[model samples]
Target: MKKTLLGLALSCVAGAALANDHDDRWMLSTNLIFNALDNNKNLESDFGLGLGLGKFLNENWTLDFEIDHVNVSQEGGGGSVDQIGLGLMTRYHFSPDSSLRPFLGLGAGYLDHNGSNNAQAVDSSDFMLNLSAGLRKEVTDRVSFLTEVKYRLDTDDYTGTASSYDDYLFSMGMSIALGAAQAAPAAAPIVEPAPQLDSDGDGVSDQSDRCPNTPAGMAVDMYGCHQVDGDDDNDGVKNSMDRCPDSRPGAVVDADGCEVQVVIELQGVYFDLDKATLKPESISILDAAVKTMGEHGTLVVEVAGHTDSSASESYNQALSERRAKVVYNYLVEKGVSADRMTWKGYGELSPIATNDTAEGRAKNRRTELVIQD
Candidate 1:
């Protein structure tokens, strides 16, 4: 029953050790023990003490060396004897959680035994080995109470004795964690913003300002100088710079800042009802659009969403806008630059197809990706 209990305790400790996240470099510990041994039909009991110094390789494992002093008395023996020995030990933690730790150690050393009658029996310094298992219960951030049981084997050449002796020791100890050891933090790479370039004496820098060529002395925002009431196409570019000012209201534009292409038709496309989530089948269409944009790096794209006539105009407008924004966000999340895209929604007001038919309404509930070169 005792052996079974010990086994259960060890298993629990091992599990705990596996769960603790320890990032430390060194550890030192000491133990006070009560030892007992059985030889043939006789039982011997003793009081023992040991001290250890250890270095931690990581949070999970440590290497240590220890020395012990013990005093033992046997039944029917005339006197008590004392012995001292030294050995090496090691421990391993199995996991990343901090509550419990299980460890194991092995050691070998020479023992010198001295009896009270001034008779010192120095058998050619014999060897000893220990097998131990224990758990450490953390009481606080830096300290823990440990309990362990060890089976020790001692070699002897008592002239008439045929075999060696074995002993069992149960120990309870408190461990103070030495704080010098810790894991290094991971490093992050540094990023520098792109440099700006400006031509044409327009106070706006080329990197951000969409309108690079501005007239010599007009008022301008960060981009460049332009007239306030002169946007013929209402495309945000003023008449002074809008080359195709009378072009259709929603035609896409080119770099001389002129309307150049009209959106004639959209290929097969479907969006979730009142939502922006792209279905699996729609992914290939979006991917193709991205590929098109990649081939023309200087061409910025505007993704606009439109909805059918069934919904309230205001709600449909907002939903349509969200659908367009979702596509834009997905592109950026997939590594497209935010500066290269624009998004808007027209709801039922800008439907390209008649609202009365199912096929026409399906076409109205669509997203259009327009390239502005």
Candidate 2:
């Protein structure tokens, strides 16, 4: 018994030596205890006082050694008995950072029975096993209120007979951690891993990121991939890549989030005086238009026809219609998608230049491919 007590006292002292600041590494506790004796023991339940020394094994585990003393009266005026216990308990505390920590405990102890003045009770001792549950509420960083209920299993018999007893113990008290709130180190601080860097400014860091060049403010998954996005305006370009996010429907776009523009023009294409036939020079420029259409399969254009003011509006309108239809038909024959092309006649009303001079009149007789979208 002396050696066991000595070892536990040394453990408590060692735990105190391992404290720093408000870490609460070691504890001193006192409890008001109530012992409920078994009915077969012929002694009434009574109150006791207990003292313990404790150590935090880690953040969530604690080791404790306690001594308790209680006086129990004999049932029929035989004399009171003194019950004392010396024990070591290991407790598991849940949710270590909370204001009120609940815990479960298991321990083993030696219970000593001492007969009082009349000597009706016999002095004996028994080994005991204990299971307990409790709560520890922090009153401050260094102090706490503790409440517990314990079940003690033992085979103790005060009278020399073939009987045994178990006990239910209730306790409530307070504990104080031993150390100054601010002090030197008893143990080294825990080391933490260095933080990983995200060079691309995406939420995911460079270490495991597959798409490290993702732009800022974009949503990404675990592997740093941009989330699947929609073409909100039905512009064929996804929102993530679209520079002009609000592009109109059917607007054709390039890979760089821009509208696919054209160097393809109908500038050199001019027609004869009163005919809808295509001039030989018109073929090259027109074929270039066909190639451009094939390159951007989504390109939609209007084949617009205009005429010089050489005739009445009614006659010029009919001539314009025939001119536009001729070019439109040629494009379809050259494999330009008909679904993406529309033909229209503006007549002399929408001429590009004045018809007052020869050069101006020639310029007014024009067929142009105007982008529709």
Q: Which is the leading candidate under TM-score?
A: 2
Q: Write the per-residue lDDT of candidate 2 for residues 312-363, one digit (tens) a residue.
A: 6887789889999999999999998889999999888976665544456667
Instruction: Compute each candidate's TM-score over C-alphas.
Output: 0.42, 0.43
Angstrom error of the Cα, residue 238, model 1: value is 14
Task: Encode model 1's per-residue lDDT on 255-305: one tens digit a residue.
Answer: 445676545233555664345677778777777776776776776778888
Any runs in candidate 1 off by more than 4 Å, and if so which? 1-25, 40-43, 116-124, 158-160, 179-373
lDDT, residue 150, model 2: 96
